[model samples]
Target chain A: MKLSKSEVEHVAKLARLELSAEEADRLTTHLNGIMAHFEKLQQLDTEGVAPTSHVIPMQNVFREDVTGPCLTAEEALANAPESSDGYFVVPQIVEV
Target chain B: MTEYEPVIGIEVHAELLTNSKMFCSCPVEFGGEPNTRTCPVCLGLPGSLPVPNRRAIEFVIRASLALNCEVKEYSDFYRKNYFYPDLPKNYQISQYDNPIGRNGWIDITVDGTVKRIGIRRVHIEEDAGKLIHASVGNESLVDYNRGGLALMEIVTEADIRSAEEAREYLVNLRAILTYIGVTNGKMEEGTLRCEPNISVRPKGTEKFGTKTELKNLNSFRAVYRGVEYEVKRQVEALQSGGRIIQETRRWDDDRGITIAMRTKEMEQEYRYFPDPDLVPMNFSAGLIEEQRSLLPELPQARKERFMKEFDLSAADAEMLTSTRAMADYYEEAVGAYPDYKGISNWIMGDFTRMLNSAGIEIDASKVKPVDLAGLLKMIADNVISGKMAKTVFEEMFNTGASPKEIVKSRGMVQVSSETELYPIIDQVISENPRIVQDFLGGKEKSFGFLVGQIMKYTQGRGNPQAVNQLLRKRLSETKG
Candidate 1:
C-alpha cells in the first residue's frame, strides 16, 4: 500500500495541479505514511462486515419533482471569472 | 482472406424526464437562456449540498423493471472525480460498485432471429453542462442550463456481432424507454446519446481484441456506420499484421471513418467514492411492488399484442408501434373502427407518409384519430373511391376539416348508383366508339380503358367496383 513518487505525480497532473519536484517527493512520503497507518487495520479479522458508505443511516433523502426558484443570469454569472453574453467563457477546447 | 468477427457493446445515456435537475431545483428543460437554470447546488459552490430527485429514482426503477433488471435494495451514489470545464463540480455523482439495476436483458431481432443482448448494468448520474465552441475565435462557452440534470446510463454486454444488430438494439431500447414515459429518447436534441465499444476477434476465438470507444454518433444510422467503419479498420489492421491499440475514437461522419482521439494510456483514473452529502438509496419490497405496477406495456409486449390482437403482419405491427404516441393513435383509431386491417393500411400508408413529409408527429397532426377512422369508414361504405379518398385526405390534413365536410364541400361523392352512371356510361360509349368496338372485339384491356374514361368524366369520384359491374352488363347487352 506504499505510494510511489510517479503515482503521486500522475495524481497531481490529473488534478491540474502544478507540483514541483520537491513537493512531489514530500507528498509521496506523506501519502505513503498515511497508507501504512491504514494498512495496520488490515491485520484485524473483519470478514463478512459490510462496507459502510455513509456515516448516517439516512436513506432516500430526496426532494419533490417540482421546480423552485433558480438563479437569474446575472446572479449566476456574478462569481464567474469571465463571462460574455450571459455565458461563462473559458479557453478554447481543442477538438479531438 | 482471414475470417474475423466483430464484437460490440453499446452504452447509451438518456436524460430522465423530471421537472427539476437531479440534485437541485433548477428546471430540467432542454433550451433556455444560458445560465438561467443555475443554482448553488448545481454550480458546486462551497457549502451547497445535493438532494436527489424522487421522481428520477422512481423512473430508474421503473425502467429497470421494464428491462427485466434486478433492482438492488440498497444502492449508493459515488463521486467520480474528473477535470472538465463543463463539469462544475469537477466530480460527477454516479453509481459505481452498486448500481440501481443490473443483469437485465433486452431482445433484439436481427435477420429474423431473436437475439437476447445482455444488459450489464443501468445506473443514474448527473449530466454535465454543454460546451459551445465558436468557429471564428479560439474561445469556448459553457451553458450550465443542462448541468446537474438526471441521466441514466444503460450498458450492454458485448453480445452484438454486427453493426445491424447494434442498430436494432438501440432502436428497440429507445422504443421501450419512450413507452415507459421515463425519457423522451430524442437523440437529435442530445437528450439521448450512444457510444459503442467495438473490437475484432478471430472467428471461433473466445478472447476479444483491443476495443475502441466511439463517440459523437448522433443517430442510429451513425451508430451503424461508426461500428461498421471501426470493425473494418480493426480487421484490416489485423490482416496487415498490426496490433490493435485501445483508444477513444471520434466518428467522422462526413468521411465515414473513425479517427483516434486518445489511447488508453491517457485514460484518467476516475477516483470514485461515496458522496458524503447524499445518503444511500434503500428500497423496500412494498416500494418495489409499487414501482413495478407503474410499468406500462413496453414496446416489445405491445408489438406482440398488436400482432395477435389486430392480426397485423410483423412489419406492420412494428411500424405501428414505432412510437408510443403513434401506437396510442393506432389503438384509438381501431377503437373507433374495428376494421383492423383497414385502419392499419391507412395509418401505415397515407398517415405515415403525411407525417414524414410534414415533419410532424401523429399526435401533433391536424387529423385526429377519429378523423382517420371516419375517413376509413367512408372508403368502406362506398361514399368515396379509394383514389378519391387520397385527395380528400390531403385536403383534410391541410385544413383540419372532417372527412364528411371535405367530401361534401368539394363535391367529391362517388357516383355509385346505376341510374346516375348509366347516361354517363352511354355518352362515353358513344364518344369512344373505337374503345367500345375493341371491347366487343374481345380486347379485355379496353374495359379498363373505358372505366378510366368514366372515372375521368366523373372527376375521379366514380365507384370503381360499380363502374366495372355496369360496364360488363352494358357490353353483354350490346352483344345480345
Candidate 2:
C-alpha cells in the first residue's frame, strides 16, 4: 500500500512527534520499502492457510502465585528528571 | 448493508518465573528501584552481549509440549525496532521469523460447554519498563525500574466466538501455566496479560469486519466487559452505517468502556527483521523430554482422581483443586486420615466457611493437617459427639492445641456407659413423674423431654444415643 505524503504526516502527528520535513521524507522511503516486502507475503496462496504469527507452539504458560520485592522510593526516583520527598517531581500538572 | 462475520484473536503476555533477567545475571525481581536491577546487558549499554537463560528456555519447552505445540529444531530471536522511553534500547529482542512453539490448542469450559481455542504461537521476548504518568503540566514522567524483564508472548488465532469463551480460555490457560510452573499467572501484578483483537459482524456471515485491539485489561472481568462493550460499539457502528476504524483502545475499568488509544499500527510499520546480534537456536530431543519428566499431575487429572479415589463430587473436586496449595492441603489431610468423606466435609463445610469469614488463607491458618485429621478421628471414634466436635475444632483453630488435649482438658468425652448415666436417669425419672405419666398415657413425645433433662443434669456429657435408647426402654417397661 502506497502511503501519501499527507498520510505519513498524519501518522507522525498522532504518534506525538515533531518530525522535520527531511525526517518525514526519509521515513516515507524507508516505510515504503518495508511495505514492499510484505507484498511478497500477500502473493502466496492463503485461502485456508492460517496466518503464521509465532514460530514456537506453546500453551498454558504460567507462573507461581507469589510476591517478591519491589523497588524502593529512592531507587524509583533516582532517574527522575526532578523529585521531591520520596516521589518523582515534575512540573505542576494543573492550573486553577 | 452486507452481512459480516466477527473474527477475534487473543495475544497473551505471560512473565516467566526465572530467577534472573533473560540476557543478564541481574535478579528478575518485581517492584525494584529505578535502574537498580539493571546492568550493562539489560540497559543495552555498549560492550554488552546476550546470554540465554537455560532454565527459561527449558520452561518454554515444557509449556510448548503442554499446549501440544510443535518445537522448531532451529529457531532464533530477532530485533523488533521501536522507540519509547520504556524501551531503553528503542527495540525489543523478540522472535521474529521463528518462535519457540507453534500450532496448539487449549480446552476451556464456557457456560457448561467445552470449547477449544487455537493458540497461534508462543515466543520469548523482553519486557519494557513501566511508564508512570505523573500528569505534570503537558507531559508525563516515565519509570525504567521494570525495564528488560523476561516475558513470553503467546498469541492465539481469531477463533473465539464470545467474551465468555475468552474468559474460560484465560482461566484454563492460567491453570495449565500454574500446573507447569512457568509464569505465576498473576494478573494483579501484570504477570499475565490479555490483549484481545475484537471485531463484530452480523450473526452468520463468513467475512471478518474491521477490529480494534483493547489493552490494559488487568482482570478477567475487565476483559469480558471490555470485549462486550467493544462488540456492542462495533455492532452499533455497523448498524448506523459508520465504518469501524482499525485502532488500539484502552479499557477504562472504572467506566467500563473501551476507549480508543491510537490507530492500530500495521506489522509493516514496525519494520521487523531478524536480530543479527544473536545466532539461530536449536534444541535436541533430550531437552524436550527432560522438561516433560518434571511435569506434575495437572488439575484435570487431579479432579478425576479426587472423584475416583476420594469419592468427592465434581463440584468439591473443582473447589479443592483450584490452586496447588489448596489441593496439597486436602491431600495431606486425607493422607493423615484415610476418611476421605469426613475430611471432605470438614474442608468444604466449616473450614472453607471459617477461612472466608476470617479473611485468611488455609495455609496461613494456625490449624495444621494433623490436627484436623485428629479432630475428625475423634468424631469418627464416637469419643466426642458431632456437636462437641465443632466446639473443639474452633478451640483448636484458635489455640493450635490438639483435639485430644482439648477434649481431655474440657471433659468433653461422651458418657456412653449405662452405669455412668444410670443415676442421673433415675433421678430424672423420679422428679419428672408428671412427664413420665404423660408418656405412659400415649404421649410418647414426653420421653424426649426426659432425655433432655437427663442430659442437662449430666452437663451435656451424657451419651445421646444411649440416653435415648435407655429412656425409651425404661418408659416402655413402666407402661405395664
Candidate 3:
C-alpha cells in the first residue's frame, strides 16, 4: 500500500521526528519499495506455517530476584546534559 | 433535574516488594537518595538487555490467585509507547494482550449487601521515576530510584455504583493484596496508587456519558471524596445542559474539586506492541499449580474461620483480620491464654487506640502477644486488679516492659490480704463518721461512699472485692 503525505507525517510525529517536505517524500518512496517486497512475499505464504517472533522455541527466561550492583548517581548522570541536586532536571513536563 | 446513576471503575498500581528491580539487579527501594539505584538497563543506556525477575512474576501470580483470577497459561510482555521524562525509556514494558491473569473478582460489602466487583486483568509492568517540581522554578527534578520497580496493575470492571462503594472496594482489595505478602499496599507512601474513571448516565438512558479519569487519590478518604465530587460535578454539568468532555481530571485536595487537566486525552495514545527484547512466558501445569499452592487463605476465608474458631462477632472478626499480622497477633495471643473474648476486647479497644495514636501497625507494635497475655494473666492471678492493669498497660505500651515488671516498678500491686487492707479500711471508716452514721440510719448508698474513700486512700490499688467484704463486716460490727 502506498503511504500518503499525511500518513508519513503522522508516523513521524508519533516517533517524535521532524521531517522536512523533501525528507518525507524520499522516505515515502523508500517505504513503498519495502512494502512492495512484502507484497511479493505475501503471495508465497504457506497455509500451515505458524507466525512467530523468534525462530527458536524459547520461553521463560528469568533472573533470580537477588540484587547485584548499581551505578552511583554521578555515574548514572554522567552522560546527561544537565543535572542538579543529585537529580536529572528537565523542563516542566506536560503529561496526562 | 433528572435522576442519574454514577458508574465507577478503579485501577490500582501496587509496587511489588521485590529485592531488586524488574529487569535489572539494582535494588528496588523507596525514599533513598536520588538516582542512587540506577543502572545501565533501568537508565535506558544503549546495548543493555533485560531479564525478567522470577520473584516479581511469582508475586503477581500470588496476588492474582488470591483475587480469584484465572491464571493464563501463556503470557507475553509488550512495550507501551509514550513520551514522558519520568520514563527513562519512552516505552514502558507492560502486558497489552494475554495478561498473566484475568476474569477475577473480589467481594466487598457496602451498605450491608455483598457484591462481587469484577477484576478485568492483573498485569505486571515497571514504574516510572518520581517527579518533584520546585516551588519557584521552570524545571522539575526526577529521581530514578523508583524507576524500573516492578508494579502490578489491577484494572476493575465498571461495577461500582457510588463513591462509597468505590472506597469499600479499594479497602477490600488492599486487604487481600497485603494479606498474601505480595505488596505493602501503602497508598500514603505511594506504593499503592488508585485511579477511578467515573461516568454518569441519565435515568432510563441506555448510553453512558463521556467519562473522566481522576488522579491524586492518595488515601481511601481521598478516593471517597474525589469520586463523590466528580459524580456531583458531572451530574451538575448534565443538569445545566452542558456536555462532559472525556479527559483526565486532577483532584484538587486543597480546593476540594476536580479540575480538568491541561493535556488532551486525544493526544495521549499508547501504541502497544510485543517487546522483542523479552521472550514470552509459557506456564506449565506444574508452574501454575506452584503459584496457586503458594496462595494462603485470603482475607475472606480467614475472616470466616476467625468467626467460627474464635467465636467472634462479624465486626470483631473483620477488625481482627484486617491485616495478616493483626489476625496472627490475635490467634497467637489467644493460644497463650484461653480468654478469647477478653483478648478481643483489649485488641479492639485499648490496643488499637494505642496503635492508632502511635501511628503504627500491629507488626510494628512494641507490645507483643505474649506480653498482652501476660498482662491479662496478672489480673487472673489476683496480683493486680483490673483497674490497676490499665495503669500497668500504659507503662507496658510505652516501654515494652513486662506486665510484672511494670507493676513492680510502679508499686501498684493489688492489696488483697486482710492484714494489709484492714488498717486502710479502718482509717476510712473513722474519717468518714458522717457516712458511717448515714449507713447506720439505713442510707444504703452511704456504704458505697465509704468504699470509694478507701479506694482513693489506697491509690486505686485496693482489691475491690476484698475491700468490699471487709468494709461490710466492719460496719455491721459497729452497728452491733
In terms of TM-score, the best-performing candidate is 1
| Residue-wise C-alpha lDDT for candidate 2, range B347-418, written one tens digit per residue | 889888988798676878888888899988887787877778889989987888999999999988988787
Chain B of candidate 1 achieves a TM-score of 0.96
Over the stretch A1-96, how does candidate 2's per-residue lDDT look in tens digits? 887777788778645578899999989888888889999878989899865434555422323332234445565555657765443444333211
Q: What is candidate 3's lDDT per residue for B76-140, written digit by digit as tens?
A: 89999987889988899999888888999999988778999999999999999998877767888
TM-score of each: 0.96, 0.76, 0.95
Off by over 4 Å in 3: A44-50, A94-96, B264-266, B435-449, B472-480
Please, what are the lDDT tens digits per residue for candidate 1 over residues B1-480?
Answer: 789999999999999999999998999876779999999999999999999999999999988888899998998899999877899899999999999899999998987999999999999999999998888687899999999999999999999999999999999999999988999888878889999999999999999889989999988899999999999999999999998888889999999998987443348789899999889889988988899998888888889999999999998899889899999999999999888999999888887898889978788899888888998999999999889899999988898999999999988899999999999898888899888899899999999999989889888888999999998898888878
Report how far residue A50 has shifted in candidate 2, in Å: 24
TM-score of 1: 0.96
| Share of native C-alpha contacts between chains A and B (below 8 angstroms) recovered by candidate 1 | 0.92
Clashes of 3: 0
- The stretch of ten residues in a row with the least summed lDDT in candidate 1 chain B is B260-269
Candidate 1 ranges beyond 4 A from true positions: B262-265
Local lDDT at B469 for model 1: 94
DockQ of 2: 0.10
Off by over 4 Å in 2: A1-96, B1-7, B31-35, B135-141, B220-243, B249-268, B353-366, B394-401, B409-480
DockQ of each model vs. true complex: 0.80, 0.10, 0.70
How much of the true A–B contact set does each candidate keep?
A: 0.92, 0.03, 0.83
